[model samples]
Target: MSKSDFGLFGLGVMGKSLSRNLAQKGFKISLFNRHVDEVEVDVAKNFKAEYQELKNALAFDNVEEFVASLASPRKIMLMVNAGKTIDIVIDNLLPYLSENDIIIDGGNSNYKKTKERFDYLQTKGIQFIGTGVSGGEEGALKGPSIMPSGTKEAYNNVSQFLETIAARDKNNLPCCTYIGPEGSGQFIKMVHNGIEYVEMQLLAEVATILKHKGKNPNEIAETLDSFKDDANSYLLEITADIFRKKEGDSWLVNLILDKAGNKGTGNWATITSAELGVPNTLIASALFSRYISFYKEHRVQFHKEYIKKSVSRLNLADDDLLKAYQFVRIINHYQGFKLIQEASEKFNWNLNLSEIARIWTNGCIIRSSLMEELVSIFKETNTILIHSKISKMIIDCKPSIKRVVSDCVLSDVTTPALSEALQFFNGITTQHSSANIIQAQRDYFGAHKYQRIDDASGKFYHTNWV
Candidate 1:
């Protein structure tokens, strides 16, 4: 058999899809899965048979044979679970791999772990690329937004395949790019997932507010559809579709359970934010909202016990709701980009914020028309707050967001994400805040010291008062 251009391990959904995508791109790929049992072997065989028409595709039941089938300076991609599974696969492949061979982890592994693996692999003279492949199952099969970070040489070696398999932008440019070195790609993907969580939560809040205002799912769907061109996001498009979905005689969305499930990435984002002291309040609130929903039983009992009178519904204009939604969406992107900016500084990643926006312009869940504006803004200036156009938009939309949030509160509707967005906006824009009192209190209790308005920079003072 001819040497395979790439090797893909883990015959799971993502792995299989990516393998097929690569093969369709005319690259010879060797597919392998850990064959601990007959069932596993059968899966690999079935996968190969399913894509047998792709003359460039091959499957191997043995790990050694899989590695051997690859061409020199072999490129192997692991699409298995994050954490220990990635390490286990790397260990298994280490014996068969030679110097300069590249191992790419296409999982949602922690950036810290990716960095550790990069260092460990470097000692063995092997290259490691911690890549972020977004767009889910269908995106993996067709094309994904790829973020790769490793040595420049390793990136150069696989750039052709990665670019070819990535989704294209409006100008027909690939959505794949070299993010930075040492787990930068995974870090960016984590932030991407974080932003996604907040965006979804905000959309759900909008839906809830619409429902409270006596709009049926169909009505809400229609209302949301109007924003599709303005927001122009995949999430919004899918949300509009979700509102229109019917199961039997009822809307499927309403029939669904209230509990939201998480896959750890949201929590990771919050944790990283806290660790970095970046104030990712919007994303954190969204994460907490999920936790709140998990207490469905308690909520039900509490509402029955304490809630007797119903609040009067406030009539809100569809235009107001749309404006508020757009405001929150912008804040969501701001918070995510702010987190990324902080991470890049702390990690010395020197990440290109504009390129990050460009890559997310398509294929990813958060892909939005707003990203085009962001790409331009970041390219012109990294100072997000100082951008005159964006700052003006925020100022102009603040009133609408405030009105919507206040009405939601009066209606007894929870809009944690929206509320946090307003708070975030206030926090960043406020020139004078009550933090001075906080510092005074800390000084009174613990002698932590406080800086006076007239004091020289970096000078701290403490006073005793009885």
Candidate 2:
């Protein structure tokens, strides 16, 4: 038989779906999943048997056989757990692999670790591609936005298959690209999740405010569905579906717990932003919202103790809500891309913001009409705040957000992400900030120096205050 064109090392949900997608695209792929005795016996075998598209796939429980089945200059993708498991899989495959073979990491891994691996693989004469695959299980089976970073030569070797299996944009072009070198793909994906956190939180806040105004699940779903403009997105669509889901006449969304769970990407994004000295208050607020949700017992007790006699009604219109959502979303996207820009400069990645926005225009969870607009915006200017079109939109939408945020506050509604977004906007746009007082206070006690406003030479002055 002819050797397989590609090889995969994990048969989990994502791995299986990707393998099926590969096979469906006519790439003969060898599949392998480690045998875990009774727990995961015949994972690869069963996966191939279950998926008709993978009829000709080579399934192997033995690592050596799986490695040997692939053609020379092998391309193996690891879909295993991130962190230690990635290293473990690479170590196992190293003994069987030849020089110049490529290994792709397809999980949500930390970019720092990916860079380390990329460097380590180079010494062994093997190429490593750290790729970020977005869109959930469904997108994996159909198509997903793919961000791949490695040596240009290595990416060229794998571009045909990667592009073939990626989601297409409105232009019918694949939603995949060469992001940059040394883990920039993973870093971009991290920022994507950060923006995702704020987006989800914004939606939840809107739902809560609407529910407080006596809107039912179906009503809310319809209300959300009516946002046919820039607010339209994959996340918004899924959220509407979630609201409409019913379980024996009861809305499934209500029965579910108030707690939200995250798998570390949000935290990583927020941390990276702070490390890079970028202002990412919206994402931080969103991450904290999830943390706050985890303490259900404490929340309940605190709520009862702090309960007011009567809360005012949110008197904002659905139009107001839509305006607020769009305004906050633009800010969130700007913050996310700004973080990426800082990382690119610091790491010398030379990451292309326009390409990143373009790939995220489809298949990704955050894909939206806004992302479609951002593709050109980033091309014209890397900074969204300075872009004439976006700046004008922000200026026009400012009043609606103010009205919505003020109403939510008076009505005793918590809109952390929205409120933080407004604050971030205000802080960023201010010509003279309150930080001068902070600098003076710091100089008073800590001997810290302050820069003069009139100084064009970028000099600092230290003052002694009694």
> Which candidate tops lDDT?
2
Q: Name model 2 segments beyond 4 Å from true.
A: none
TM-score of each: 0.97, 0.98
For model 2, how does the per-residue alpha-carbon lDDT over 271-349 read when each residue is reduced to its tens digit? Answer: 9988999989988999999999999999999989997556766778988888889899999999999999999999999
What is the alpha-carbon lDDT for the whole of candidate 1?
A: 0.89
The TM-score, computed over Cα atoms with residue i paired to residue i, of candidate 2 is: 0.98
Clashing pairs in 1: none
- As a TM-score, model 1 comes out at 0.97
Residues 1-466, model 1: lDDT tens digits: 7898998999889998898899888888888887766456556667888765455577777989889999998999999999899998899899999999999999998999999999999999999999998999999988899999999999999999999999998888999999999999999999999999998998898888888888899999998899886676898889999999999999999888999999888999999999999888988899999999999999999999987878667688877888888888888888899889999999899999999999998878788888878988999887676789878877878898999989888778789988888988888889999999999999999999988899679799989956
Residue pairs in candidate 2 whose N, alpha carbon or C atoms collide under 3 angstroms: none
